[model samples]
Target: MPVREMKIDDLPQVLQIQKALAFQDWNERQFIAEITANYALCVVYVAAALHTPILGYAIFHLMGPDSELLSIATNDSHQRAGIGTALLNAGIAHLDFENGDKIFLEVREGNTKARRFYEKHGFEPYAERKKYYADGENAILYVKAT
Candidate 1:
């Protein structure tokens, strides 16, 4: 249950977790970009076993006082095991909250489980973006303030 900064060499296992999840479509190139971005916070939840090195991943971008949680997910086989929570808590702790930073994230309108998860972590739903996704589902925006 150790969370650490994501490394390029971990992409294969990370991609496998991403492919098993439904929300994120980010490819290897995108992950590489994030890992290299100065303002991006990308982390992975890892296991000791070599066969399943990564169990979850979280990506965030920080801009001055605003931070955005771009994506976070746990492998299907690892779901309900607190990996997601560990990833999210680590990401939030990285944000510059002392300066009154606020974190933002969006969830698909129909994703009740995700909404609940965010809410449980103290994110409050504030707004909605219509037809935000290609599938035309509204995006519910949630925010957490320092």
Candidate 2:
């Protein structure tokens, strides 16, 4: 698992994964903006020996001691192979290096598997936003103290 800063060339593969796994898809401009934002960090996980295909990606923003995990997703074909875990670990390490004290993210209330995964990774339920998604699903917020 090679997790590194996302490059412009990786956006295509990243968009593919996002379209498959994300609740809302972001366009190339959004991805580029996040990657270039001063307060943001964007990374991609490449699994092949040649590092050609991106398996997953994470976008986070750091503000003082707080960090927000904006998005994270793995390719549908590469799920369960630890790519998501690796990308998360990398994001955590980056945030810790930046002296961040906590990280937060939101998941759909109906996404039990994602909530379970976050729980297993030391994230605890913190709050909820009713009718947060476009489909009217509630959003469950999870927080982790780093």
Candidate 3:
């Protein structure tokens, strides 16, 4: 699988991928605004194939020096095929780790699959935010320290 930064033309595909994997309503306009405003380090991943639709994407926000993984989603059709891991690894590699020794992300408390994915990548549970999801689930904050 190949990973790269997302282009403007990739928004629709990205949206589709997000919808396929998302557990809540994520506004595309808000996502676009945040990404464009922080384009210096934020990115999205696309699996490579002949005219293949997007299988997954990851979004990150670099604040100060540390990176925050805003969201990561792999389409349901492509789940369990390592696409999510590939996207995450690619995003992690893109960070300026020499200056920032940590990456953080949040997953819903009930999202066992997502939590397991983060844990498999060496992320540790560090904190919790109550009612973080629109559906009223708390969120567990996971961090990977380099």
Which candidate has the highest lDDT of all?
Answer: 1
lDDT of 3 by residue, 87-116 (tens): 888887777577538888888899999999
- The most accurate candidate by TM-score is 1
lDDT of 1 by residue, 1-146 (tens): 39999999999998988887767788899999999999999999989776877888999998868889999988888788898899998987777477567999999999988898899899999999999999899999999988
Query: How many clashes (backbone atoms < 3 Å, residues ≥3 apart in a chain or on different chains) does model 2 have?
Result: 0
Give the better candidate number (1 or 3) by lDDT: 1
Better of 1 and 3 by TM-score: 1
Question: What local lDDT score does residue 36 receive in model 2, on the 0 to 100 scale?
Answer: 86
* Residue 115 accuracy (lDDT) in model 3: 94
- lDDT computed for candidate 1: 0.89
Candidate 2 residue 74 Cα shift, in angstroms, is 0.8
What lDDT tens digits, residue by residue, belong to model 2 across residues 1-146?
A: 49999988899888888887766678999999998899998999887665547888898898768788888888787777888788889988877644338899999999886788789899999899999998899999998886
Assess each prediction's global lDDT (C-alpha) against the native: 0.89, 0.85, 0.77
Off by over 4 Å in 3: 39-42, 47-51
Residue 21 in candidate 2, Cα distance off native in Å: 2.3
Name the runs in model 1 displaced over 4 angstroms.
none
